[model samples]
Target: MRSPLRSRLVLLSTCALLLATLSGCDDDSGPTPDAGSQLPEDSGTPDSGAPDASTDSGIPDSGAPDASTDSGTPDSGAPDASTEEPWDGGYTVLEEHGDWIDRGRYAPCSFNRQGDPSTVRCDDLSRYDLSQCSPEALAQLDAYGIYMTDLRGEVPRSDGGTGLLPAFAGFMLHSDGGTDTMNTAPLDFRNTDGGTFFIGSSRTNPITGTTLTALAGCQVPSPGIITGCYARCINGSFNRAGTFEAHRMPSHRGESESSGGLRLISESPVAVGEAVDVYVTKNHAYVVSLDRISGTSGGLTVFDVSDRAHPLFKASISLPGDSSWNGVWAKGDALYIAGNDTGTLIYDISNPAQPEYVRHLPAGQFGVHTVLVDGNRLYGMSPDMVTLVYDVTSPLAPVLLQRITVPEELSSGGAHDAFPYEGRLYVSNGFGGYSVMDVTDLDNVRHLGQYVHGSFAHHSAVGTFAGRTIAFEGTEFNGSHLRVLDVTDPTNIVKIGEFRLSPVNSIHNLILKGNHLYAAWYQEGVRVLDVSNPTKPRQVAHYTTFRDGDPGRRGILFEGTFGIRVPGDGHVYVADSVRGLLILNEL
Candidate 1:
C-alpha cells in the first residue's frame, strides 16, 4: 500500500513532466522529439497542404491532419486518451465550471521580484483558465489542495506615500462543486503550470465597506512550499504590490525541532482555553488568558516558577462580566492587565504569587486591548481609537490623565498595541497606521508623526541604535515581516530593513533588548535578530514552539507562537498557541 506522502510526490513528478513539454522543455536538457506536439502544422487547407516540411517549430507530423477530408478532423496526435483525463488514476477533478468572481478595479496593482511596483494596472484572473493546464499541473494541484498563505504588500495612500500591511489569506481548490474560488482560504482554483500558480480573490472590505481584490502569482519551489508576488486593489483603484511565500500546513504527525541555545527549562498549560501573554515579576509568572471563540469566562492564571524545571499553578482570577484579558505588565509591585470588558484591571502583586484585584481604571467598558508601563506612566490602548494615559505613581490606584485621540480614519479600526520610549509613544492604531506620538506631557498628548501604510498595524517595539532612533514594527496577518524604520526624524521616517520567514508565518509581540530583537513569530516560532545594522537585520537564533501534533492545533493558519518576553532574566518566556507557557534560555 502506498503512503499518502509517496502518492503526492508521484503526482508532483507527473505534473512537472506535462508542463515541461507544453513550455517547449525550457530545461537545460533541450527539447523533446514531440516538443510542440500539441500545435498543428497545418489546417490541411488546399494552400497549406502536406504538413509544411519547412516549418521549424519542432512539432512532428501525425500522418496528415486533413481538416477538409471526408472524414472529420482527426486527433491532433495527442498521446494516450487516458492521460487526457488528468485525474483518472489517483486524483479527483472539480466538476463545477463557471466564470470566477470578478470585481473589476480601474487599475490593479502588480509587483516585481524585489517587492516593488512593476505595474500599477494589470490583468485579473478572469482571462486565466485551468482547462489549458497539463495533466501534471492538475495532479500537482490535487496533491496540494487547501492551504493558507501570509501576504505582505503596500497600499498606496492618497497622500502619495505607501502603507505596508499584512494580510492573511488561503487557497482552496475543492473537488466538490460548491467552493471553487481562490486568493484566500476555503475557496478554490488559481491557475497552475506544472507547480507554478496564480491565485486571486475579490471581496468587499467589511470595515470600510470598500471593494477589495487580491491576486498572487506563485511557484512551488518544492513539493510543499510556494513563493510568489501579490497585488492588492481597493475601492476600484490600484493599491500596491509585494511578495509572499508559504508552506503546506504540517500534518497531524508533523516534524519536530529540538531546542538549541534556547533550552526549555520549564513549561505548563493554562487551565483556561487560550493562554496569550505572560509577565514575570520576581519569582512568579502571571499569564493572561483570552476567552475567544465561544466562552463566557477568561482571566489571569498565576504560576510559581521559582524552580526552573517545574512550575506550580497558584491562583486564578476570573470576573463575572470581565473575562477577556489580553495584555499584562508589571510596575513595581503592581500588575496592570488590559481587559476587553473592563479597562485596566489593576492587581496588587506585592506578594508575587498571590495577586489581589484592586480596581478597574476609567471604570466601565473601556475595551483596552493592550497595556504598557514606563516609569510612573501607564499607556493603555482603547479599541475606540484613543490611548488613555494614567499616572500610576501609586500602584494600587491609577489616575486617568488624558485621552489622545487617533486620527478619525485610523481610530475607526481600533488601537491594537502601544510601546513607550523616551518621550514618544509608538502606537499601532489597528489598521489605521503606525503613529509616533509625543506623550512627554500627560496633560496634552500630541501626535508627532504617523507611519500610515497598508491597512494593518498590530504591534511594535522601538529602540535607539547608533545615535538613530529605530522602530521595529510588525503587523499581524499573512506575509508580515519585521519592518525596520529610522524614526529619528518622526516627520520623515524611512524604511531601512525588513525580515520575513514564510508568508504563512505571522509576527505577534516583539521586544527590543539592547541590540537583539526577540519576536514570537506565529508558525516560524521565536526569532532572535541582531539589528545592530538597522539597514540589515540578521536572525541570530530561534526556538520553535509549535508542533503540528500538539493538542488543539488546527488548520486556521495562525496557530503557533502568540507572545514573548525577555525581561533581563537571562531567559525568554513565550506563550505558545498550543504548548502554553514555555521557558527558554537564550543563546
Candidate 2:
C-alpha cells in the first residue's frame, strides 16, 4: 500500500518520463512494462532517478586507496593458478530456436474475451509432452531455494511470421513445498518434486486496464535447469506464448553459498525502505534506500562501523515527503545525497554520528539519481538526459558549473550514471548505450565516442589494466551481464571479456579495488572477480547475501544486493534490498 504522498512523489520524480526514454515506451498504445516489471511484484517504474549508491569511480580522498595503488597483484582469495584455467570468454548465450507453437490451435484453453481472468483455465497438462521430463532426477533437486528462468521463444507476428521475444521470471520454493511467483502467494503452483513444474498467476495491467494471466510449465532437463513453455493472456485472450529455460541461481556451477575466502562478517537490517546504496567514511557507513510498495519510507541510515565485526546504529533520517534517497557520497565534513525530489542534499557530518541538514543544491524540484566526486568536481547524473557538474572545492557549498548534455542522437535514454577515469568521463546512457566524453575542459566538453549495445546501460567502473584503459559496464534488465571493454581508444571501444550468472538476475553496482572487481549483483550476491588479466575476468571469491525468508524478499528481479563499496577498507559494505546493510570481510 503506497501512501498518497509517495504516489505524488513518484509522479513528480518523472519516472514515467525516464521509463519512456529508456524503454522506448509507445505513447499512443500506452506504456509497455519493462522486462523486469512484467511480473506483478514490480511497479514497472525506475527508482526515483534510477541511481545506484556508491556510483563513485573509486575510493574518495577519505583515507581510501588511490588509483595509483590499484596496480598490485591479485588479492589473497584468487583462484589457484594450478587448478583453475583462465576463462575463454565463452558462456551460454540464449538464442531463438525459430520454432513456434500455436496455443490457439493446440491447447484447449481459450481467452475469455469477457475480460475476466477467472474464466481462463491454465491447468490443462495435456498441452505439453511429458515424455522428456525426468521425474526421478527432478525429485532429487534441492526444492527449497530461488530459481530464475529465462524465456527465449518465438511469438506470432501479424505478418503471418514469427518474432523473437525474451522474458524472465523468478520463483521461490519454500521448505514446506509451497511456491511463490513474483511475490504472488497462493498461486496455482504445483510440481512433481522437480520433474514437472507449473505455476499460474494474474495481475491487472495498469496501462490497458485489463487482467493479464500467465501460465508456465517446464520439464526438468537436469538439476538446476528447467525447459518448458509459457503463455500470457490479456483479458483472457492469448497475447503471447514462448518457451523458457530456467536455472537455479545459488551454488552456481557446483559452487557453494560462498567461494574462495569471502565470508560474511555481520548483517545489519535497514529499517528504511529498500536499501539500495551505501558509502563509508570517517569510520561510518551511510546507507540510502527508496520507498517500497511494502509501505516503508526511503531515507538515510547511519552506522558507526568502528568495529568491523559489529556495527552500531547511529541514526536514521527520513524527511517528510522527500524520502527517496538513492545515492550517497562524502568529502571532508560535507556529505552529498542524491535526492529525487530535491537536487543534491548536503549534510554536515562534522558530528560523524549525527548528520545535520545543511541544504540542497540548485534548489526546486531537481532530480539527481546518482552522484560522483573526483578531485574538486562533483557529477550528478539526472534522468533528464544531462549530467550536472558542480565544483565542490569548498566541500559544503558546491557551485553549479554546467549541465553537460550529449548529442540528441545519443541522449534518447538519459544519463543513468557515470565514472571518471583519467580526465575522461564514461557515461552509462540508458538505451542510447555507453558514451565516452572528454571533460578535461568543462567549457569545451566533447563527446569522444559511444558504444551502442542493445540493453539498458546502467552503471560502470573504469580503470587502467595492463597498459589499457578497461571498463567494466553492467546493464539493467533480464540477461544483462558484465561487459569488459577496452576503451584505450574512445573512438573504437571493443569488448574483450564478460562475466555472467543466471540471465534472470542482474548486476546493480560495482567497484574496482586494485586487481579485484567487487560487484553487488542482485540475487547472485557479492561477486569478487580477478581481472588482473583484463581479457579474462574470473570469479575468485563471493558471498551470498540472499536467503529465502529475508524481510522484503519479494522474489522479484531486483530484490537482493543493490549497492557495494570497497573503499580499500578491510571490509566490504553492501546494501541489500531485504537484508539491509551487510558487512563482509574483504578478500
Which is the leading candidate under TM-score? Answer: 2
Provide the RMSD of all predictions against the true structure, rounded to 1 decimal: 24.3, 7.2
Q: Candidate 1 regions off by >4 Å?
A: 1-128, 131-146, 150-220, 226-246, 250-260, 294-296, 363-366, 409-412
Per-model TM values vs. the true structure: 0.64, 0.81
Query: Tens digit of lDDT per residue, candidate 2, span 279-342?
Result: 8878888999887765568999999888868889999999977888888888778888888777
Give residue 271's error in model 2 in angstroms: 2.6
Model 1 scores a C-alpha lDDT of 0.55
Compared to the true structure, candidate 1 yields what TM-score? 0.64
In order, candidate lDDTs are 0.55, 0.64
lDDT of 1 by residue, 242-266 (tens): 5544456531113345322455788
